[model samples]
Target: MDRIDVHQHLLPPGYRAALEANGVVAAGGRELPDWSPASAEQVMAGAGIGSAVLSISTPGTTFLSDPAQADQLARSVNDYAAELSAAAPRTFGFFATVPLPDVDAAAAEAVRALDTLHADGVVLLGNARGVYLGEEGQEALFRVLDERSAVAFVHPADLPGPAVPGVLPFAADFLLDTTRAAYLLVRNGIRQRFPNIKFVLSHGGGFVPYASHRMSLGIFTQTGRSPIEVLEELAGFYFDTALSSSAAALPTLLTFAEPGHVLYGSDWPFAPEPAVHYFDAGLAEFPGCDEATRDAIRRTNAAALFPRFGAVPAPVPEPPLLTRLRRRARTRIFRVIARAAGRR
Candidate 1:
């Protein structure tokens, strides 16, 4: 299928230089790299991806302590993304950045980015300045997204609490942060209250897939809810396969999530290796899916979430002869194996 990647990132040249000049470090104190738009396009093209939805990854707009500087950087980043999308209409779409720690300013910027800039959605770090999205002070931000029916792209950010020594923080902490936010939303009734907002969780719902049994246990034993109930609610949530590209993880995600609930994503610039790895893993492991289901995850699901790519062509269909041959081969193999086992 002609794939649409919904989790790419584009860094403004000026902003990137500033990060390097200021010695700003990302998770694990790794110095930020100079991620340019050209590099992003090259990577996407090399992967044979048709289009990508760009978002600010981490150390988000609020990284600058000064609210004014934060706002300016956010605006610049959004404008740069919009400009890049214009240059290659078929190759790029963007999720606008918002400066947190100042709700009023962030709301205003959100309106402008959506209405004027035509941003596909808004990118929000899971925790901004140590505050989770559903917390009391951050309620207004959620209200804005819900009111606008915006796609809220939630990615992991460093927590405000003290870091543990000898632990590679981001590797584990990032997924845990996503899990924490998702759990908070469900427990606090945010999903039920704000049905209009569409939340897209990065990294295949971030531990939600593997730990689902425990979630079900908690509900049945303590909360009086079924796993199906939790899963159904979570089904309304969207997921992107960014870095968790394990051989087992992708298939497990397909089993847990309906095809329409998953989208293609590459947490680019920060870690392009994951993007390449996922494409390889998905292509090899998911060959059994029908074309329709494969098309949905590869491109259609993202197009539905972000209408910018609504007009992009669907994947070309496979030939009937090839399909028949594969089916026959599978049947023959099964028959041979069964006879050898004396089932025949």
Candidate 2:
């Protein structure tokens, strides 16, 4: 047990039922994954993950048409996560889920989660009902998050409008969705205005690290703000390497992220176990990461963010020979599937 995974997900029974009741059988173009606490623990143990900051993945509360229902579900999932973290304080931390697009309810839920539930942070979708963060009607929520200086984990939801036929949102649209939120947050001055809120962008901030300059230039041309300033603000966000830790992607993320800003993430359950191992191995094998840098990305950086997990005693070491063989075989199969899916 060494690394602190900041981007893991929790799929509580109640949460899953809610989605099913709402006719959402899938998210990001994939079927809902089976998840249980025991299964999550087993995966973490095998991967040498000391703790995981659990969060609800995308299509958050916005899936529900009724605001009251959305808020109720958010509260239920947050309570469930708090209980799990309480049961094993060293093994778990959680980001609270909030009912968004309804700003008042969102603010109240965020306040409750931070002040009462004691969540490490809140998980926010890139867009809620087509309203991206930093857009109008979202100020109250930001103010609450800012006041508490919460770690808001921004996850991507489905892209607005009908999906392109045969293309999955997770394959390419998720990146653009996250980039949209990042750009709007900078352009609308949310990052500057609410400087206390630590925004952790998921999937290595979508395409932000790679296309930042182009985005900044677009912002510069529209508003009088400097491109350099936009880039600086975008770079200020914390990035988690979930499924984005390939050799090609990792270097760009490391280059764009500031010291102590990169954190580990294994998007379990939603990301199949083999895919998790594949990306984890990719992170481990990248040549640019020296021992110290790897340590920071794996553990120290996240420990600094959630200090309670920093001192957890090491668990049993991962088994080597069998695990390596399994990882290699499964990773190859996952790579082929990912390539066919057109994921980068």
Candidate 3:
């Protein structure tokens, strides 16, 4: 099967320098993996990936305290990725990085990347600085994304809180981080309002599939909305099988994700070669997936999302204005409730 890996990471020279200058050597409790175009190609070839959509892993520009510095680094790395894709259009594509928490600057960079550089999409950390995706401060960025109908790949950063003793963030907290962002996106009605921007959650949507009902009930308790409606919205987000393609996780992910919403992801570099092959093998051998579904996961679904890969994107119908208004209003109420409960 021809595989298109959507959840791959690229550590550009400039980015690596930035990390070092900031005295940051680890992410999610793991040392950063080394990467180069040659190495990336070798790994992809061995893994049977025909194409890989690249993005910078966690701590994306968040480590930089200065907005200008963060924006500069984001631009440099995006340029590097664009050049690689230009060299080999079929073998490589990239998701542009943005200087988030600097909302205007981030929006500007996203536009430049999508229109000028032709990035496959943009990668967003689950939380930038301390701002989560659904927070009001992120509205401007989301508006820019919605206008372009962009694809936003949600990757996790280290938790805002201190790491527990002896436990690495990537081992477990990374999952919670993605789950939090997904919840807020649905709770704040981002998915409904920004219907055009396709959101892909990494690591099989973290704890989303497993804890969806509990989350929906939590939302229902706050907004008085139907739990079923909330659950449906939660299911609408796309999921990638990265470290989540195990026999146990695969079935839940496959069952929860809507048809065409589950995509292949290797989480390469960050996830070492052995782990990548192990999970890839698990996906290949999973009996729950038929040939058609496996094909879809490997390439077809991604092609449909990224027309640059040579498949036509299916047209999505827009929700009525009145419905959007109601949803936005309800989402606002939920936000207020969260605020009152001392959550951010």
Candidate 4:
């Protein structure tokens, strides 16, 4: 089917060994699914996806606290995945992993992967060692990514809080992890500032689309300025339909995300074949869009994101003039209210 899957996952042998050494037998509290290039290819064919952009899932290099080791494991994983992509140019392209909380190493690897390895993009966790994205400390990393106009694919890792006994992190906590990242990114103006870098939040941005107004209000509550001013910035983020292609979730994601920003994603092999097929079927049957829109979401949107894959240049969207005008008008009122009273 000419679909381009933008959020497919890979498990590198060396990275798996590192996880085993660290006693992390599970990722985000779920058993890791078996993955090989052959298996991946078969799954893609079954799902009717033409290409799968591979990435190492959560508990990635960030799981390793040792900066040196993190860097080493990241480089090795990237190298391996790059080799896989190189071997199967048509079926695979990889999003390079980076050693986060180690800005220099990440930047260097990013340069290598993008330049030499010909990686499609970079995958980053929403948080590393309790440091969420858009925090002051992560600014350096963001700057490097922004310089290249890189596609920054953000995946959710385990949240720092205590885990509830019954529910798995993927079932609940993962969603909040992504939402929190989106929150911090927008409130801190990172999303606004980084126009060049395209940030794709996985799992359909994990409630960001549904709870956007609340999130915007939350930002306004903290900072005096109304988040209303940058609501368009929040919508600019790309969302992937990884385990999120449903009637319930699609409405918000489609309505809230800018057109051509929602791309297809099958969270395999982490999702396993059964689960992957379930969502793939759901996407196929979802009545959210007509043939044109579905085609755009499944392939054309991603093709726009990774031009090397399909070379379909993105149709430049006209700016939201109405939103901009509303922002300008509301900014004055919010500023007056903020100045009249100190932050709550």
Reference-based TM-score of each model? 0.82, 0.89, 0.90, 0.90
lDDT tens readout by residue for model 3, 10-41: 99988999899889998888898899999999
Clashes of 3: 0
Q: Candidate 2 on 1-344: residue-level lDDT in tens? A: 98899999999999999899889999899999999999999999999998999999988889888999999999999999999999999998999999988899999999999999899999989999899987976889999999988899999999999999999999899988999999899988899889999999999999999998678768766775756567668778999999998999987787776667889999887899999999999998999777777888899888777889875334323323544464356446544544554443
Q: Residue 297 of candidate 4: its Cα lDDT?
A: 86
How well does candidate 3 match the true structure in TM-score terms? 0.90
* Model 3 lDDT at residue 343: 43
Off by over 4 Å in 4: 313-344
- After superposing candidate 2 on the true structure, give the runs of residues whose Cα lies further than 4 Å from its correct spot: 311-344
Please estimate how well model 1 matches the true structure, expressed as its whole-model Cα lDDT: 0.73
Give one digit per residue, the lDDT tens place, for model 1 in 1-344: 26788777776777776565656656434446557667776777777677888887777865688899889989998998899888988788888889986887888888899889888889888778877765556667678788889998888887678878766656778888887777767656688778888888898888887776566445444565544456556655788877755566776666555437778776776665555766556654665566676667777778877666676445434434554474456446544543554432
1 or 3, which is superior by lDDT? Answer: 3
Estimate every model's Cα lDDT from 0 to 1. Answer: 0.73, 0.87, 0.88, 0.83
Question: For model 2, what is the alpha-carbon lDDT of residue 241?
Answer: 94
Clashing pairs in 2: none
